[model samples]
Target: MYNLKFLLLAIFLYSSCKANISITSIDSLISVTDDQLYENNVDYITQNAEKILKFSELNNYEKGKLYGNFFLGVTARMHGDNENMVRYTFAAEKLAKEYDDKYVLAFIFLQKATIYKEAGLYNSALNFINQGLTVSNSIQQYEKRNCAKGKLLVYKAICMSYLNPEWKQILRINLEAMKLLEKAGKPFGYDYNYLNVASTYETLGELDKAEFFYRKSLKVSTGNLKGMGYCNLAHLAFLHGRFEDATNYANTSLDYQENNSNKRYRDIAEIYQLLTKIYTETGNTAAAKKSEKLFEYYHNKENYTNELFKKKLLIQLLAKAELNQKDFEMEVSKKSRNLLVFSVISMVLIICLGMIYMKQVKSNRKTIEKNNEQLSELSQQINNSFSEVLELAKSDDPAFIPRFKEVYPVFYQNLLSRYPDLTIAQIRFCCLLRLNFSTKEVAHYHRLTIKGVQTRKTRLRKQLNIPSDADLNLWMMNLG
Candidate 1:
């Protein structure tokens, strides 16, 4: 009960006063690679991109322009805007040339090779990777050179798996890259390479070797890399009609992928394609279409993706609107509660002021009921002391005294603390009388007289805030 009250107090305290992020109109169709992912964290991509664009506009190499445009290109690729990817890359390359930085050229060429690789142009990808490698070698950047070689080998392996697509050739090149990367002690980027090789071997109908290297790849990779490696292994299992195993592995991959950035779009697209194939084989056209559409949605180039993104943006807008409506309702409810609380507080204050005015009038004048109430309280207290002294009636007792200053004080005093105007005391005192105190008894107990108590009681009744004599005691108690 205490916890619940605290929670309610917290909600009331926070309420509608909290700073709200009024979602501005999102032009999602035009806002490609738009909102910063994980808004609470530093929007590193956006910060750097702005720096780059600012520098480029002024024809300067300010800040991290090289990395900024590279990332922009990568994001454009995810949104399937191949034209934007190329454009961004071209801008970055121009900046790189301006600096005469081989590292920048190597990086840009690597990025371009990745673009070509995604488009299924093996030779084009190799040409770009080779250019990157040449630059890496000239700079004597062994780690980066190894990275370039690893990337080139992976591209060749992928092209081999798809084009002419000799599984043996794919396996051989990937294996060679694996050994080289390991020897160079630069295995970070090439973690997925071995898994792709194993998958290729599986396509060549070598399940034993496929299983072998898949496990090997998994041993070296963890987190999303491991998730993807398992996903590929699952694909092989799906090809072998192991649906249960496939689903299990795919689910693990998704679990990891969901928490991480969606950086592996092409790989995930392939995974979905495999799932689509499985669904098609099982005669599940709806499921197959969903997977196929998802694959095309992520894998295809600019124009088609832009059309799809427009449709998706409409759906997202509807969803965001629904969420905003719910947020508004929560806000409204919070405001209503604040109003109710303030309303109660205002009413209490008004009644208290009325009681205080009556007390003043009693000092200056007198009333018949004022005389009568003290007599009543006196009689009641005498009876109570004789009947039995309640523990609460003792002056030194915790319940008898005002807990604040540890002293005996008026019933009206406690009421004034809460209402500051003896707001409900007029009616609430009647309930006090029902605790078996007469007007005189109440006065003697609280240290007042028959006339004084009666005067106060009469004033209390007059000051009762509620209209129509609706038993203000009931109303106040109900607030608890």
Candidate 2:
């Protein structure tokens, strides 16, 4: 019994180890879908992605499930399976957000933009492209960030071409995308960029520039891209009335399309339509009818496919409306929080300024009070000196002149300095005037008649060079 138990325990341990290894291997396998997509192996990607999805579900591997759903959505888009593409893409988006995987989220945004572009919803396409760019910019890896941004910019240019009629702006956006891709060494969509720039040049009626970009597109293109290049060249030739060149170019486009594994029906229809126009213009009635029939056949098929896409789009739009509503609510909440924060900061700043202003006002009030007190004390001291000088002059004391000179030293010095020839009595007369005494009081203090005082004042005015209209007493008080 002990031996049997030991054998069962060993078997269980080995099984557990095998299961862990299998889960790890699935993680690595799911990562290769990106490479498969870049190589244009859509069929292989679909098969491998579906198997990854199954194993991930069985093992409950979240990251594996995310990549599997994303790549499947990419394949679904290539196959024109709009419904499944939307379903898978949204599923991957939900998982990516849960994992906080910015790289996968950026790609998902691009896929959404592409879906909207294919459905002719240019406004919505632009919205997703901008969102993808925002996420791409947040990526820490330089090459990955630039590569992701480059792809989004290409899509943005395509969407803008439909929504905006400004060809120059569209060309600028296309060139910016090419520059970013070149810097990253990715060259993700050079063919698309060249084709778009060529188309823009054609729209601007610059035939030479348009032909140069078309040739550039053909040089870097393969498969359907090469076919598209020939078709656009054919259309350009037709527009310029080169019937033979248009016919040859259109036939070459058709030949390339015939061998393209991933043929674009709309492009094929455009080539046939161009051929029909060429044959009709060149007077080849039989060939014109044949080309017209082929054009109608492919055009009808393209329309049917578009109709199916529109139907699927209607269903997706309903779901998208709900998602948009949620996004709007979150944005509103974010703005509310920001407003609350701003209000609090503003309140704090206002309070600080108010406190500073109040402190300055109090300081100024204290300084003004101190200055007023000092001025009042100085004025009282000057009044006391004036009283003492007047008392001595009123009593006719012998020391009155000397006392007056001490009380008003500057006035005494200015009078003596300007008039050294003045007598002692004249100097005493000036001292009484400097005290602001009335004419009668000055005559009384000097023991002379008012007329004698007036005569002394006239002589003093002449000695001082005072103006005729000036008051002598006033001038003496203001002398220094």
Candidate 3:
């Protein structure tokens, strides 16, 4: 497959501008995974990943670096170290599963099973291996099938040898292990199976046959199986009373083993015991005593280490339980936080709705008050207009003033509030004038001259304490 980053770079450099370069980079990175399509597309996926790692510097490419981790994990496990393998492969598995990269997930899970097997976690190894098998079978990928099946058989063999209760089960599994290894053409696995078979034979007290298989295991194993093959051969040699051969093989195993590795203390103590027994048998009393002292030192050292390891394992298990408890608490806290956030959200929504309801209610009340005020004002205006129509119809009638004086008797009383000396005749004239009638109309209504009506209006105004300069007509209109 072509490098997705390079294609994106071509587009970025050749494009007119750099406005959407980041978005383009993300698309290109996503397209890298899209380019691979198969259940076991680990190679193309890895190649795509290498392209980004080689070219891209940003953490955006990090999400695609899982395949690299997967490969490194495989290498680490092949070198007989499961801790680093677990570290790398777990990260890779998490990333692959998140992306729904089925092929990558399956492959990494298969490798994760291998790591578990090396770590002696048989159940975990089988579980991971089965998961891989399920996914691979669903996709019908033969490569994944071969990988999972081969590793699973080896895991079964180890589990049977170490933990199986039935002797027939152990032998059946070891034989199946050899056949599976032969089918897979894995020399390393075959040599490991041979060593296990030799141990089984040794347990059965078949020394010569055990020695034959142990030597065969020693011959077939690669450089990677250094300490294992030699250690087993040296143990067999010691059992057979071949002290010099035992020492030679022990020395070779020690040379290959690391100082602080899992094999060191056991190897040291076992070699010391073998030397002590050999020196004692050879009549070398001084050498025997020195070897015995060394044996005691290494033996005590191994016992102390075993106790320390058990303590550490206890601490790890306790720490794991504590971590699980913390996780449970954290999950509870998160749920509580979610519920709290929901409550706050609900409260805010309720308050906002309440405020909105109050505002609407206040607005409705204002509208109702305004409508009532308008109705009252309209009723008053209608009453006043009807009274003016009635007065206009009665303006020409002489009984109108008499009728008005009778109907509105408080007119004189109101006039007296402003002028205590206001006369009855002046009030009548004032009442006729207040109707806005013409002087001629007022004369006809009151049976008087137009000049007389005007004179009477002036007299009425003066009695009401009117100013000579003020407009009576405007004053009456304002009063009305």
Off by over 4 Å in 3: 1-64, 71-86, 99-144, 162-164, 206-209, 222-224, 238-244, 258-263, 296-480
Q: Write the per-residue lDDT of candidate 3 for residues 1-480, one digit (tens) a residue.
A: 379988988897776355347445644764654434222244455565555444433444445465556555555555444445556676677777776666667667667666544434456556775687566555444543544455455555555555554655665666665665566454545566787777777777877877777778777764435566676777777777787887788678666654533455665666667767767776888988987787788788777554333333223323333454566556655655655566567885766655655565566557556445434443443445337434643554544544454334355346556666656666555565555667887787557888887787777666667788877656654453
Instruction: Give per-model TM-scores.
Output: 0.43, 0.63, 0.47
- Residue pairs with colliding backbones in model 2 are none
Lowest-sum lDDT 10-residue window in model 1 = 21-30
- Using TM-score as the measure, the top candidate is 2
Which residue pairs show backbone clashes in model 3? none
What's each prediction's clash count? Answer: 24, 0, 0
| Ranking according to TM-score, highest score first | 2, 3, 1
TM-score of 3: 0.47
Q: Cα lDDT of model 1 overall? A: 0.58
Model 1 Cα lDDT, one tens digit per residue, 1-480: 999999999997675334121111111211232224212112455554555455544543332455467557656654556667776777678777876777657767877776655544456567777787677676566754565566656665765555566667767888877766765565554557777777777778888888888888887776667878878878878878988788678767766655666445655676677778877877889988998898887676434333333333223323333454566556655655655566567886756655554564454234334434433443443344323224354232432322211211233344556565543334335434434466767786667788987686556555655444555445444433
Q: Which lDDT tens digits does candidate 2 get at residues 392-442? A: 888877767765665566788988887899899778777778777777887
